[model samples]
Target: MERILREPLETYSTQKTQKFVGNPLANKLRGEYQRLLEEILPDRNRYLVVGSPGKGNWASCPWIAILDSLITDTAQSGYYPVLIFKEDMTGVYLSLNQGVTRVKEYYKRNAKNVLRVIAQDYRAKIEIDNEDLTEIDLASRNNNAKLYEAGNIIAKYYPADNLPTTTELIQDVRRFLNLYEELIFNDTQIDETKNLTALEKKQYRLHFRIERNSNIANKVKQHKGYKCEGCKFTFSSMYGSLGKEFIEAHHLIPISTLNLGNVQVNIETDFAVLCSNCHSMIHRLDDPSNLELLQKIIKDNLT
Candidate 1:
């Protein structure tokens, strides 16, 4: 684990970025490092362990992540625990961070603000014993670096000079993995059905649906631009930079009505991209899918 974390920090930037992927170090991160983590990952079957030197071009700060199957198998979208090297390679962070890609698609130029808001929300709600890490410095001004800095929920740092023993690293990883699973289980199965009347109950029922499937949302946005399908209003028109590419995906088939099992939502047909105002108003109707009725109400209400 130390070697996996150290080699990239020590050698990644020294090597040219374009050819870095073919390098042995990159191969080890992409292949061998994941196998070592596979051996240690809890309920190992539930995770798709992966590491990245970069996608097409080499990353300035490379990472090896333990991604959960329920949230996402890729580092591109869901939150996951990852060991990412700093830009300067002086240290690395064991960080619970988010995937910036989907956020970028949803918010376009305003993703940084959205990511920061989410990080703040998570920090406020979730409690980690001694791992109440606040901020991370990837030490670069790269776009991904900036996004990662905002996306970081919590982190533990290890300096390059003082890398821990493989066993210690393994222990830390396993403990963090357990915490990761706890976050997933808590978030994935939100049953308000089970009655709870405690102070913590409010926190338990806290609905911060942290990018559960922002990809689907992105696809909906892609199919229907940021304009409100119900009102033909675009957020960016009024709010400019703050509202660029902003819209919510409203389910044409109400989630409560649909069978959770074997139900597939087609991005092109099953969802409507509505501004938040229209999104809320659509639910007032008996059939939320009836955009025609929603439009008529708006037209009639105009004075």
Candidate 2:
């Protein structure tokens, strides 16, 4: 384990560590990290594992990021509960990374309240940057555990002698996400607004819906193959190589349930692989078109 932690730092001192997506060594290190996380969190299976052994850019320092599956989707719709291991730094950190996502501003608006909840709920000491956080915030803030990155706040969990157990770490993160859900995604006022047109309201609701869980989609495509889940239509087979490897990801879970915030998505159960035509037909209506329902429709048409 110490060797796993030391690998990136050693690699980065000479050059940036390569991307973790297909690297065996980097992946093994993440597997070890997952083992450590699972030992502490009983519900750890629900979380998707993500991040790289080190930031690939030549200028960036060595770091490992393990992100929650739901939040790791696209960096826009959900909050990423991250566990970061910095080679130069002594211990791992429990952080909420919204900085890389499109919703950084949304998090910034409620940062103060979010910090308060973290402190009151978990008894964890946290730090926040006083200045306004911008895109540059990502490059500038580092090494100083004293100031939390404002756009996406973070707190140290394993600082040398004061390493937190898995239970303590889980409690801290859960408390933080609960408060985040309450403050950000639970707004009912927008739905109740008296001023918007029908089309406008539709657009408003879409902000919560269109964010794709790519991890689930990619996993489904890899395991299930790129054929349409409903009709078994293979784009490549039909179009001769031009359409190879191209398929759409459809969310099988009902859309109404997504607004509840922090909902755990079961990749195997919640998504389907589809061709473009079937995907469009399924979502022709506002709600998620049911998989079984669509299958029946296709069967009937063929008959």
lDDT per residue (tens digit) for residues 1-303 in model 1: 567877777777776444754688778888998898888765666678889888777787888889865356568776788998898899998988888999989988899889888877665655676655778999988998899998888888999999878998988887777667556545544445545444323333221121235656777788888889888899889999999999998767643445422335677877888888997788666566788899898888885
| Tens digit per residue, CA lDDT, model 2, 146-213 | 12243244444455446555456666656545444343333323445346565544443433333344
Each prediction's Cα RMSD?
A: 7.5, 10.8
Which residue runs of candidate 2 sit more than 4 Å off their true CA positions?
1-34, 48-64, 70-79, 83-93, 98-170, 177-216, 222-244, 251-272, 284-303
TM-score of each: 0.63, 0.43
Instruction: Mark the regions of model 1 whose C-alpha exceeds 4 Å error after superposition.
Output: 188-193, 196-303
lDDT of 1: 0.75
Query: How displaced is residue 292 in candidate 1, in Å?
Result: 32
Clashes of 2: 0
